[model samples]
Target: MPAQPIHTNRLILIPFTLKITKTLMAGDIGILQKLGLQLTPYWPDQEAIDTFPKIIHNLEKVTEPTGFESYMVVHRNSMSVIGDAGFKGLPNDDGEVDIGYAIITQAQKNGYGLEVAKGLASWAFKQPSVKAITARCLLDNKPSARVLEKLGMQQVSTDVELIRWKMMNPAHEQDTIDC
Candidate 1:
């Protein structure tokens, strides 16, 4: 399947391509560490640089596949990889897509997450067949919920501690949320 592109006023959402340079890999590690995400169960911290070759090899397989395209959310002004944002898994006929994102810890609370999400989700809506975009956030994550709201997504349901927000028309919204 062909990957699609997403663009926003501040971001350029390109398709996921895994080419882990020594520098980028190192930056990934540092960014993860600063975000406190290294402690997350989904991905563990790399204890050594030697382990990156194997890690990158495995990442190559995970990154390049249908329904899973990651984008390095670069800041238009700074031109830095502040974080990663993407859609993972298959969205159903409901026009829903599972949105995922993680910004470097230092970048949080600066409104960058909401900024990138608006761009990415808007881009996703412009896809050939996309009708809506959905995102799940831990119920305790008020910031994420706010970001969803900023993108004009409304809460439709919940699972465990997760709250689901869906946006039906990102391309047409004038002002997304009260925030």
Candidate 2:
């Protein structure tokens, strides 16, 4: 089955398909209309545009999205894609997956970042293969650090340039219970 859209209180995370990523990379706004989505003036910003090729390459590896790739972050109220967020890919050998999110400048500070991160983590934990989710932010990016902290992730380590964080799935513990 195709991955279903993940709905949070204020946003809908639609998994990016090959077609959507290609169209967006081609600089076509028609894809927005076709998907019944609106675009914020700040969306498709340079970072998002640059990520399309990677998203496309990942999408090509699977016949359908497994909800482990990029998703369009749409505001529930405006139906406008404010940004993008999702897992970098499937879980690693250790059953850990890395996540990342970006909300357009105009949509920042509305708690959307936390909402989307929580939603993604929640969805990921439901997958039997996912035991933990990880993320990273620059040492100077306090806002991003705050979002990760809000999602219950702990700062596992840090390099000169980046802070790495991780959150283990609570359900994984329950599954290992000896009762």
Q: Pick by lDDT: which candidate is best?
A: 2
Global local distance difference test of model 1: 0.61
Model 2 gets an lDDT of: 0.92
Report lDDT (CA) for all predictions.
Answer: 0.61, 0.92
The candidate that wins on TM-score is 2
TM-score of 1: 0.64
Worst 10-residue lDDT window for candidate 1 reads: 39-48
Candidate 2 ranges with C-alpha deviation above 4 Å? 174-179
Candidate no. 2 TM-score: 0.95
Q: What is the clash count for each candidate, in the order shown?
A: 0, 0
C-alpha RMSD of each candidate structure in angstroms: 8.5, 1.9
**Can you write out model 2's per-residue Cα lDDT over 1-179, one digit (the tens) per residue?**
78899999989999999988998899997799789987557789998998998899889988999899999999988899999999888899989999999998988999999999999999999998998899999999999999999899999999999999998889786655744
Candidate 1 regions with alpha-carbon error over 4 angstroms: 1-5, 20-68, 170-179
